[model samples]
Target: MGDEDFLLDGRPHRILSGALHYFRVHPDQWADRIRKARLMGLNTIETYVAWNAHAPERGVFDTSGGLDLGRFLDLIAAEGMHAIVRPGPYICAEWTNGGLPAWLFQDPSVGVRSFEPQYLAAIEEYLQALAPILVPRQIDRGGPIVLVQIENEYGAYGDDARYLERLVELNRAIGLTVPFTTVDQPTAEMLEAGSIPGLHKTASFGSRSLERLATLRTHQPDGPLMCSEFWDGWFDHWGAHHHTTDVSQAAGELDDLLATGASVNLYMFHGGTNFGFTNGANDKGVFQPLVTSYDYDAPLDEAGNPTAKYWAMRDVIAQYAPVPEERPSAGSPAPRFEVELDRAAALFDVVESLGTFTAHDHPPTMDELGQYEGFILYRAEIDCVGPAVLEVDEVRDRAQVFFEGDGIGVLARTHHVHSLSLPRDARGTVDLLVEDQGRVNYGSRIGEPKGLIGAVRLCGEPLGRWRAAGLDVGRLDVVRRALRPVAPISGPSYRAGTFSLDESRDLFLDTSGWGKGVVWVNGFSLGRYWSAGPQRSLYVPAPVLRAGENEIIVLELNGVPHRPAVFTEGLELGHTEF
Candidate 1:
């Protein structure tokens, strides 16, 4: 970074980069995705380090399996490409808790992303743990990492200069020698607020490349112009229509951007699956949880296959940089099959075996129990007889109400339904099974806990002495121990089946026929799927499968009429605009 250009070894360099998150994609497919980026005429591959995924719990950090950060970067370097690492204490990349660990917010006193001592101390602890892996990967240290990013998009969140300053200092103290940069939308207020005097500034936008970069250049008058996040496609919400952008229109914009002699990084060269319970949500006035597939409608689809957009962008980039002579290889289609769910077990039959319940006078939120991601059961013994109004002050996302071992009704936050009428008597044990769809990944609601919030009331009276149980559902042994070969009753139950594969390959579990729930194959969670329009299938990578017989267990939260698990060669992601 210099007065006029981004200098690499005393010469001006334009970064032709594309974003591809390693956490989102399967570990086995990292090389394939990176190679495809090179095929698209990109010289650099950028990614964000998900703090929540790496350090899921405090004092417990994992870099093994799919969460291997070092392996991802080494693969990029092996392929002769540069890297940009954005390790954010607050990323806001539509991830769970915006990549902030849930335990960090347990103590309300610690003001996160601010200059608070407790919060800063936690940030320091995280950086200290992460530094060992990232320090040796910097470009100066014979590694591929060229530029390291500071707190991501701080201007959109808050304008705390001291907070941003401390973050930069922390990175430097950890021995990161690469040049630092701050990204924000191309606006005078954002560019001025997010960037420090010496830190290089970059803008993030999809269109109007000439104007956005001009806006960026005005603030960074002496530096090279760059669009850090060129959002060529968009993500899909649970019920919203699938989003797409015109290929020709986007390519024309790319031409206009290249014509301005500005550097650009496509926001997503490959948008992978939000595997397991890692998908996030958004809430403006309405709360909308993000679907299982990140897809993003990028050049590469969710299955990592090149689309028309890939060639369109490749042609545009060829004018600026050299593209590979060889084209990308086509992916093998998934085999289509259907397996009958012969075994079934009701959730209530196994809820007790999952975990022990905590006794509370008033129902506690998910954070209070140190349970962040899954479903929590708040059971209370209530004495009543016929139809009554059951009210939960706030349902985090969705709740299924049960009274005296009978299915009553559901209360959903999306529909603004807090009160529902119970058809049966509110006698014996009254249960409210709450599901944590996802934490708000952006805005002021980021740190708010999941599960049942506030008081639980029946007939205008608050319920007390509740026993709450957390169902992570990721516990294979517990679920295996609890699941029995019983007849399938209505409501929430575990549906199980087995199928044999001749060979292992990428597959998609068509979940359009099923209701809302999570799916697991051979104990590896394929993430969540819903009958709710947009996303109709869950991506199952071949790595999770074997040549022999394979088992799949589905925890169908809302019961479906049929008990058949279907497979598809391609993703049946509802509406097909992307």
Candidate 2:
């Protein structure tokens, strides 16, 4: 990876690579994803090793199931494709906490992505745990992993040399013998800030801009010029329009970059789903929540099916690289049908198991309580008259207001709504069920906390005596068969239904006209959905289904009349005019 022109085994290697996250796709679908990339003419594969997915808690690590890197890499090697491993203790791959574990917040005073002793120690500890499992798979040890990336795109954040130097040393100290690389904006500032003394430098861009490539050449003239993250497509967001990159333009730009003799890596040749609450939010100028479907509008759709973009890129890339002529046929399209949900339940039936109660003078944020994903409840007693407005200083994501166990209104960051109408009544408990959709995984607002991190005022008076609770339900099994009442669609409620299929295939559950909530099918959580105009269907993989029966449970936070139904029609991806 370090040689001029990036010679591998003393031979010229044009790294036609594509990014594919193992955690994003199901464990059973790893081979299919890599096969699709290879069929698209990609000779190399790229992936970010999510630290949080591997170790959800402090001092604990999980590598079985979807977190199994060894099995994933072995599959890649078996396919005869090379690998570029990005083990960023800080991989900003639209992952929750930027791939950093939530348990790290047990000590919030520690500044993240910095040279602070605590931050460095945390990174080192994570690397130490991962190194043993990772090193044996490196090419040096006859594994497929050839190149390792340090902290991801750090120059956009700051120019911390000690941090970069220390991380590079740590990789080496932990037996990473492969060449280490750093990617940046292709400018002198980013190159200087993100690059180490001996590390290779690569440019990241989404367009066919000559100036960007020139900038890379100007800085790393002695080495191979490559586009580490040649952004072939984009990620979608809630309330924002669905993102779709022009495949024609992308194909032309890819050809242009290859003509310049630079190796290229498509950011996501196959965009996978951000299953569960693993999706990360974004903050460029406004706070936007990332959709559950990481479908990145890439060459391959979320379900490992190729798109028009995939075909276009394949035609152009085959002209440059010696691609395979025999490609796998796109499997038979899955049949679509309507299924009626006949059963139901309420969320309060299991609220006891959903959250841990705590008392506070003021509401605390998710970070304050060491929680990463899911919702939190804030309750305080206050006297208010009818038609009065309740002012909460800040709502990081979304909140549902409840007046003495009755749902009243909602506060979401997307709509920029803050104040909600209060009921005219005597002093009572004011409950705010706040949902931390996701923390911004990229940009300046990277570490913003969720929940009511500020004061609550009733009309004009400060309210006191608060109790906060957290609801991070990844599964609804604790009360799977627990019987509860079937309440209205409004308020926080859980609905249950069962459907049977003689045969199984990939499917989507339409959530249109439904309130915001989380969906669980056969004990696996599919992620979040909001009625906010964009994503309306949740991707349910085939393996999760059985021959006889299937079950679905929804925990909706808002009170609205909605029936559980699914259709095979096209997905309702939200669209924006811009």
Candidate 3:
């Protein structure tokens, strides 16, 4: 199909599209998701090209396994739908620092999403790296990608038209053939700020009110009008309850937009998980680590299962748009055998055997020690450390201090850092545990360094002779093979149980009783889960499931072996009581 084939009014088109990340759902379920989008009357599949997900490290990129973007596009094309690829060097999808690689914070001088020479240069490198995969698939290349987005919601950040124009120029320089666009809230100044040449401006409004369109027109009347991000659903943080929107209200607004011949894209038809440390925080002055499950109260849930909202929106769109004739199947087939995990190896053993070095006078920073991301361990022998105050000049977020083998104290510096009392000890061997919660992904100062930026000191002396442990926990293979249990596996340890299946199908790994940590099926990391509040289980795709016996492992932070953990056919873990 030609570019106009997907367009509504000589414009690239009003894609009643849904946002779904390829990394969030199982590779096996990609087709299912696209089919569901089609059934929902979605003619386009809009997705943010997550830089971090695609390139976990600076030089290393993985499109294999579940990170395959090309296969994802192929699936979208197979469903006869157009694709809107938002390849953001900075995608603020509630991802850690808005999809910025955590390692980028390692560079002290780097400022993200700005016109800063260092920042822009890094972004250019990222684009160049990703171009080989995307450029060939642009609409001109006979691929489904029709419209490419410039930056995500730029108006929310700055009104720098120069920066916006530069971004447009950057994409063009990289050979992105699709017409370009930018998304921002419907404000006069923001619309003006995000506008560029041959660049369409889209407003993110909650309703179908023409006011937002009028605002865009008043500012950039020469460009195509669109709703770049329609908030079909909202996202939930770690401690908040799940957010649910009124489908009827959303449907009414969507119907109104379509009736008026307007083009709109649902913010997320499916909001995938912010796997690993990829979850980001908003600029509300509150550190909101996105829940592992990014279901986002979307038309499609995190597990790629269609929600009531999906049907409601689909019915509404079917009235004005041409929807798929047949509905996609609801759930994947059940896996043949539900694998069982019995016990977890101890983490202390791994630490003890990691080999020791001479005690240091001062703690090391993330850079000096040749480490890039995650936690650092600082150990030292101090004279005044007995019952002395342990002071991390600036603990990025969390620190656990162990005095001579005993867990002395835990200090959470999420708000402020200082004066954490140390346990009394005659023999002065002090070990400080520090974890980098990742830098803020959105808004101003997004490039702030996370983790331990400086040295760790006790009283007035700098800590030295430290052996740092790099907990750059990103992949599932590492979580499984790095079986050194830090603390004891407590509470009810759910033993892996096996169940035979005739065909491959999707299943939800129930995590109701487990406190938190990660889950793996046959070595596939489903993502993290916490019993603290909100999310309960992780989704396992059928494609990853085998016909024979499969293994399921749950690395529970606070779980004791009790009943055998069960796997069900549905995506909702609540359906199966643990």
lDDT for each candidate structure: 0.87, 0.81, 0.67
TM-score of 1: 0.98
In model 3, what lDDT does residue 399 have? Answer: 65
lDDT of candidate 3 over 1-578, digit per residue (tens): 12222353344555678888887777776887788888888888988887877666678777896788888998888888888888877778777667776677676777666677777776788888778878988777788888898888876777666677777778889898777878888887777666666677778877755777777667665545678788888776655577767989988888777776667788888877665555665546555556667777788877676778888888988887787788765555443223345445533334433323334345555544544344556666666735567666766555667776566655665455554666555357776666555456678746555545566656656655665554433333443455442334533122333455565666777667666566667766676676655766676766767787777666453444443566655544221111
For 1-578, candidate 2 gives per-residue lDDT tens digits of: 44458888878778899999989988888998998888888988999999988887778889999999888999999999989999988888988878887666666688788888987887888889888778998987899988899989998888888888999988999899987889998778988788877888898998955778998888887778889999988888887778888889999899888887789889988878888888898876677778899888888888777889999999989888888887767656556766555555555556667788888887888778777778787877777676568888889788888887877788877777878877666467778888888878887666667888688878777777888878766546665666354544446777777888897767777888687888888888888898874787888887788888888877767756757566564455666455
The regions of model 3 sitting more than 4 angstroms off are 1-13, 332-341, 352-361, 365-374, 382-386, 413-419, 426-428, 437-439, 453-465, 472-503, 558-578
Candidate 2 off by > 4 Å: 1-3, 385-387, 484-489, 576-578
- Number of colliding residue pairs in each model: 1, 13, 36
Q: Model 2 scores what on Cα lDDT?
A: 0.81
User: Each model's TM-score?
Assistant: 0.98, 0.96, 0.86
The count of residue-pair clashes in candidate 2 stands at 13
List candidate 1 segments past 4 Å from native.
385-387, 482-486, 576-578
Q: Candidate 3's error at 185, in angstroms?
A: 0.8
